[model samples]
Target: MSTVQDYASRLSDPGSRKMGTFSYLPPMSPQQIRKQIDWIVQNGWNPAIEHVEPQHAMHSYWYMWKLPMFGETDIDLVLAELEACHRANPGNHVRLIGYDNFSQSQGANMVIYRGRAV
Candidate 1:
């Protein structure tokens, strides 16, 4: 039988990576950012960039209202579209906003923006 340590090791092995996205609702505070980071770590999703490192490749912030109000249905597709949009735009970092999943869908469903922070 496998020991608890074995399972724990598997979960913590950064090599076991999962891709997920984040988008922030407007009016969010620093505390909210901490909460979000905690959620990500707890979920075992490893970000491509370190949270504290300057010039991280995939750091972002998203405003809720900027998201598309309707038309598109699938969250994944929306995320892909938003990512593509960001790729087209010039920027150092991108934050997905309004990428929400309402129906208990798993994984990332955030709408984000990509640009250099001022």
Candidate 2:
């Protein structure tokens, strides 16, 4: 008995979705992203980057930028991968997804980064 309007309203609610450490906030800067990656590494989680064409603002199923960085203690390497993904997929939506084997096998954290407008 839910109508299309109800679904649309929920989808449009900014508070309904939470991405990584930020919610209803602008994209984080490179330094902020590096800090987050460092935290994830400290917690013993693996990080990976993915990207999508971004036909919609909240599109999922992004393609992987490269293999997940497991046991990678180098924050510079993670940042480098992020930059590489952004360079290769300009105008697309990129995300950093973390995996925690201690609890969930995948998607421990996720942050979306909008690419430059074409």
Candidate 3:
């Protein structure tokens, strides 16, 4: 088995990972996360949450958390749901998605939580 140092070394290698958008950004504070939710609401983007084991994070499909929050404008509500998802599936990689209804595709996708050290 690869030791933590080995895993860390691999992760440290440039181009070793090609994950979601937020994965590139520094971990967001709760306030920052709230702002992101607000941006989603302001743009009228449909919000959804999905999660998967860290090892399977590169897989295309992740288990959805309940359903998409359609027509949801309350940032607090979205934050609460994200918290619930993380609590329910502790140590799972969690992501937030913003689907564009007009384009019928995902407009924004980002990793909100990355689970590891299991």
Best by lDDT: 3
Give the RMSD in angstroms, all C-alphas superposed, for model 1. 13.9
* Candidate 2 residue 1 C-alpha distance from true site, Å: 30
TM-score of 2: 0.72
For each candidate, the alpha-carbon lDDT, in order, equals 0.36, 0.70, 0.81
lDDT of 2 by residue, 15-61 (tens): 34444446445667777788888888888989988887545435646
Per-residue lDDT over 1-118 for candidate 1, one digit per residue giving the tens place of the 0 to 100 score? 8754322212333322122423222434545544553454445442221111113333343222234423343444534544555565545333432222444332433223334533
lDDT: worst 10-residue window of model 2: 5-14
Quote each prediction's TM-score.
Answer: 0.28, 0.72, 0.82
Candidate 3 TM-score, C-alpha based: 0.82
- Clashing residue pairs in candidate 3 are none
Residue 78 CA displacement from its true place in model 2, Å: 0.2
> Distance from true position, residue 99, model 3, in Å?
0.7
Model 1 bad stretches (over 4 Å): 1-24, 50-91, 96-106, 109-118
